[model samples]
Target: MSNRSIGLDGPLYDYLLEHSLREPEILAELRAETANLPEANMQIAPEQGQFMALLARLMGARRYLEIGTFTGYSALAIALALPEDGTVVTLDKSAQWTTTARRYWERAGVSGRIRLELGEAGNTLQALEAEGETSRFDLAFIDADKTGYPDYFEHCLRLVRAGGLILVDNTLWHGSVADPDDTREDTRAIRAFNDALHHDERIDLSLAPIGDGLTLARRR
Candidate 1:
């Protein structure tokens, strides 16, 4: 079997976006603004955001949860996809970055649908659990620090309803996870997380070869 794909090599990816991407003006503006940041790479690719939004819509997700909220592009996409009654609870520790996020959410007029929490994700997750939020979310997206991926998945698994979906970002770690000599902390953690998910029976799994790699786990 060959892993080679024409899209990764050249114009195919650009064509994919040209024909398929229907980014709202607000989202385009947000993406453009985020592109200037020093940590801009942290943003998920636009196509990936669109993909996740379609998934949320397909699953009829009414309650959404996001573990990482960098500039809020992903949240905005999900919020737009959800119905008026849908809600998204997103967690992030960066007040500075999330301030940018909040501005965009307000611009998109989805601020009311999204609740932003500023603190350690673990603390927030535990708090949600204590508030009887078990199985409360219809979908959860884990894009936080890679070291916390394992714990985040555990919490999201419990917070999201049975049969709900969990999306984990950067599972491929920019192709570094396939290189044994990398030995980076983030890479190792992602590798372990991927291995664990592959064996875990609580969910069905598929690691998609999308931007930076996205792993989909559906609770049983």
Candidate 2:
């Protein structure tokens, strides 16, 4: 067996999806519609969504928080995995994109379980904290602006309960975090975020090489 994660070529990646991915029809439809958008890259991969849903199911997650709701694909994934009493509070600033997301969430019959909050995510997070929401969620997913990751993470640390999971998307930043010369704004932000989390003792961490990159942080 390989000691490191195996590189996935086009053929291999296709094979992996064909053999393992279980993207539901509604999610597939949502993915298809999102693929036409200019910011389609913002959407998480199907496999990544499935993987996250599995995590929620395994954790028996009931209260989930999402910082970004791009087309609501990831939120829908987790919503499906949660029980009838489960709820998802997803935040986003884009009305147009989230409109598409809402339609699909309705089609999937999980709209009632998901509450969409529209506004600046940081401000909303602060409001949640002010509303006595400390350590209240079972899981939190951050996938919004790269620069806002640090602030969002801090909010999640408090919003997510002890021993809960906080998942950060695009932590590897399309592999740019490894390039010493790529000093771009978002790249730098992601790098700094990763570095801080590396030495952070409050949570157990692992950066999985899936999609852009999925960072799993389990609060201690």
Candidate 3:
């Protein structure tokens, strides 16, 4: 058996999902509906949602922060894993998409636990920081604009308490990160962000090969 993570081919991927995935009915419905959208790829994979939910439970996460809330699948997963008192504050620029997210959140009966803030995320994050919100969150997830990752990560670090967790999505960028010839703007940004996280001294980092790629950073 290999010591490292194995590459998942079509059959292997299917096997993994069959054996490991445990998606909720509502989440599954959300996934199916999102699949028909033009920007459906922005949705996190079901397995990734499960994994993040596990992370939330393991960390005893209560106050959650999400930088991107496209259709709210990830937020819902995290919310389901949390206690009734736990809450998630999610930010997104699209009222249209988040409106759909709110509908599902309400259906899941976790609407009261999720606070959606609409508008430019960067400015919103700055406002949070300006309001003395440093070290206020237990966990922060970043899955928004690729170009804004660095800024998002910085704000997330500031918002999370010492020893809190920060989860960054799309770190692999569909494997374009490792290809020297693939210098797309988003690719370059992800690559640069990955490198910075790799060298950052304030956090413990792991680049897990889940859904495109997920980077976990625990504040030190």
Candidate 4:
């Protein structure tokens, strides 16, 4: 056996879910619904959602933030884990996708806890900063456009409290980041972001080999 994380084959993945996944019925239903969408691949894996939810609970997160809310699955995952008084502000440009997300959120009865900000995420973030919202969030998740990741992370660093956590999705870009020959713009952007994060002293970082690769950066 190698001294590293074990790669999950189909059977092993099924077993992992069978033994550990505690996905709620509502979440399962949402996943099923999102599966039929044209951008279904944009949805985060259920297991990844569960992991983020647990992490939120462990950190006692309250004021959560999200950069890209694809169909609201990830946001729902975090919102569901929050206490009644907790809130999540999710930003996305597409009214269509967010409308779908809103439906699921309403159905889950967690709609009241999530605020949707539909606009250019970068500008929205700047507005928040201009309003003197510094270190205001407990956790911020980034799953937006790959090119915007660096900017999103910078804003998240300001919005998240000292010692707060920032979760970046698709850091691996579906394994493209590790492929030297993948010269695609998105791949390059992800690689650049990862490299910068690796050397950044303002946060403590760890790249997890979960759904599409998740990077955890805790502000210092």
lDDT of 2 by residue, 1-220 (tens): 7799988999999999999999999999999999999999999999999999999999999999999998999999999999999999999999999999999999999999999999999999999999998999999999999999999999999999999999999998878999999999999999999999999999999999999899999999
Residues 6-118 of candidate 4 have per-residue lDDT tens digits of 78889999999999999999899989999999899999999999999999999999989999997899999999999999999999999988888999899999999999999
lDDT of 1: 0.95
In model 3, which residue pairs have backbone atoms overlapping below 3 Å?
none
**Reference-based lDDT, each prediction:** 0.95, 0.95, 0.95, 0.94
lDDT tens digits by residue: candidate 3, 74-170: 9999999999999899999999999889999999999999999998999999998998888989999999999999999999989999989999999
Best by TM-score: 2
Cα RMSD (Å) between model 4 and the true structure?
Answer: 1.0
lDDT of candidate 3 vs native?
A: 0.95
lDDT of 1 by residue, 168-213 (tens): 9999898999999999898999999999999999999999989999
lDDT of 1 at 215: 98
Report the Cα lDDT for residue 186, model 3.
96
TM, every model: 0.97, 0.99, 0.98, 0.97
Candidate 1 has its poorest 10 consecutive residues by lDDT at 1-10
